[model samples]
Target: MNINIFRRKRKIIVPVLTEEKAKETLVRCQSCGNLIEYEDLRKNLKVCPYCGYHFRMTVSERINLIADSGTFSEIDTEIKAVDMLGFKDLLTYKERIKQTKKETGLDCAVITGKAKIGGFNAAVGVFAFEFIGGSLGSATGEKLTKLIEYAKKHKLPLIIVFSSGGERIHEGIYSLMQVAKIIQAVDSFKESGRLFMPVLTNPSYCGAAAIAMTGSIVIAEKGSLIGVSGPRITREVANKNIPGKLKQAESLLQNGFLDTVVDRHLLKTTIAQFLKHYNRRTI
Candidate 1:
């Protein structure tokens, strides 16, 4: 059988993106389902322009956003976690630590340092959730304790950004011990009469929430999950359908659990204003 087929050639357009180009291109807004350009998102400090949803920021990004340019001096950079238990489940604790270090480039879950915020010196500690969900462990607690002590010694205000999943179960009882260490450190730091401000971001749960709540003034980013346990765990433990809004920053603020809930766009300015006001009163 012989058949005659006439086909029209059409132009095919396929966009090729390099690694850098692909990363810098369009990003989907999780809240509003808008496809936003990456540059626009960065300009807006990674907030969703459509629905005003604040995106989670990296440690470096948060530091740059809050600290003055060339003013961040990181301390306790050499502290790294050790596999004291040598325990293994799916992977060894040592292996897990190594993997997270390779991925996040952090010695521990938290980074402690001194930074100048709005021209005022303060000891700053920021959690990197990329490091094993920013679990509270011995190393993290030590770093935080040192940060508090440094703040007290220098008579500087203390600012810590809390973002953690809870205690690191891998570290066993050692991780749980950190809660006491943190509380004691904060208690002594309070005696100095310097401000201790905690910035609670998304997923501030369990021990992290407890530590942040101890701050002289607690501020949470808008839409942050500020609670002891997350919704799922709370539902399972209580055996009831927990209210979805109960653990949110807005709800916490309304219920007197939070001092302020600031939008991402105004977070730096708001914190600076608080610092300035507090310093003036003390002076």
Candidate 2:
């Protein structure tokens, strides 16, 4: 008996689109109106190629972009805020903390870790702008000190990606203490002959600016606001108009407060070069 050969037909499948899927599929650059793939945006370090507009990056993303591949070892990841005064203004401090946690997925404003930059080991700390405006609270101070200590112990250079609105107002005076604490830590690290590099991102103001200036080498992002107070706040408090762009990174660099003002695209290369020069000198 002859048996007939049968062939199975391949089924064609097509993806169905929902409103949410369509919305999330792609986005245009706000500045250039150029279509950008979601994954491409992330891979490009959150910069729009069409217009050269830099997108805001979270602390983790900053760390990932700066650090060598698979080299970041995080420390003090569980440190969180505490409501010592039981502060309750417009919203309960506890509830505010919960909201920030949910929104940012970070326990505090800063994340401390160790990573390699250009094959040179360094201690890295990045401030989470999404977390309460990257406010300096007790936990932030503690983590910063811990990072410095780690750097000292490992004889590695310390790098901080600082972006903050200064101290956390809800935390009151406790937040102010962080300024002095971090300053002392940086000073000690310097006294030990180790390098402390502070990469100042946009809107670094108040206490954070003060601490950032203490770095052995301070670099600011192009067009970043580097000041104790923003223009709007200064104008409001002084009852007068402040000059536009008073606190821009370029102005700070001109005034010699910043060592360099670097473009977002060249930041990694600049940092790597600095680290290379530093390591060669130390060796």
Candidate 3:
């Protein structure tokens, strides 16, 4: 597969509430150059009709795809990112949080909850890349840790869908600390002999990559990328450009970094099948 095709700029399809708005919206596939109606694209699980390119999905879309209908119950809804250090760039951390919340309707980059997946209950957390690139912040880590603990208590399977860019820079050291906290939580969860399934999606970098790699089974969406650091940082540190195929899911599967690379359409079915197998073994 030519991973270069994924590097091209594609039209961003904003979710519209009304049917009329959805009908009026059109997105162009970056890989195949096909014009796709927003409604049709959504019904097709946001995969391009012509080229089968898997487009990035929001947290709600992802949850809907994987979780059984009306079975997800969210936890830690009140926890939100704050301006811990009063960090400022062009915008203050407070301003950025407010703006991101308004834009994405999310309190943090990830949402954690108890959900029935393929009719089996599990603890699930999903990351939305639009929320500050799904960066891991203090609140994000807290929620995930709590979720892992909940799963541990209940002896339920843990599933985390990672689509993060890196640690949230606005929180500085606080953001970095989350990696340690989460790792501790994950360790405790694993001691109970429960399964940890990490589904890596597009742009899983830095701390996200570390956590996902620790899972019992590492799964990746087709066309996703998994790397320690992004291109700019790699160029500065290593004095070289990131190899095009180095982080691609297909390449990772070949090199044994991932257990499987699943298509977006088949993800729910595949995951359910795994859960069934795990359940049978445990029983």
Q: Write the per-residue lDDT of candidate 3 for residues 1-283, one digit (tens) a residue.
A: 2333234564444332234445678887766888898888889998988888887888899999999999999999998988879888767889889998887788899999999999988999999888988999999999999999999999899999999989998899999999999999999889889999999988799999999988998899998878988765676567789886788899989998899999999999888988999899889
Once fitted onto the true fold, the runs of candidate 2 whose alpha carbons sit more than 4 angstroms away are 1-40
Task: Order candidates by TM-score, high to low.
Answer: 3, 1, 2
Score residue 121 of candidate 1 by CA lDDT.
79
Off by over 4 Å in 1: 1-22, 235-240
Error of 1 at 206 (Å): 0.6
Q: For candidate 1, lDDT tens digit of each residue in 1-283?
A: 2211113232322122223544768977767789888778778887889998777777778899999999999998888888888878667999989988876678899998999898887899999876887899889999999999999999999999988889988899999999999899999989878899999998799999999999999999999887777775576566677786788899999999899999988888988999999999888
Structural similarity to truth (TM-score) of each candidate: 0.89, 0.86, 0.90
Which candidate achieves the best TM-score against the true structure? 3
Poorly placed runs, candidate 3 (over 4 Å): 1-23, 232-239
C-alpha lDDT values of all predictions: 0.84, 0.82, 0.88
Error of 1 at 121 (Å): 0.8
Please tell me which predicted candidate would have the highest lDDT against the true structure: 3
Candidate ordering by lDDT (highest first): 3, 1, 2
At residue 34, what lDDT does model 2 achieve?
86
Candidate 2 lDDT by residue in tens digits, 135-248: 999999999999998899889999999888788888999999989998998888899999999999877999889999999899988778878886756765676777757788
Model with the higher TM-score, candidate 1 or 3: 3
Q: Over all chains combined, what TM-score does candidate 2 have?
A: 0.86
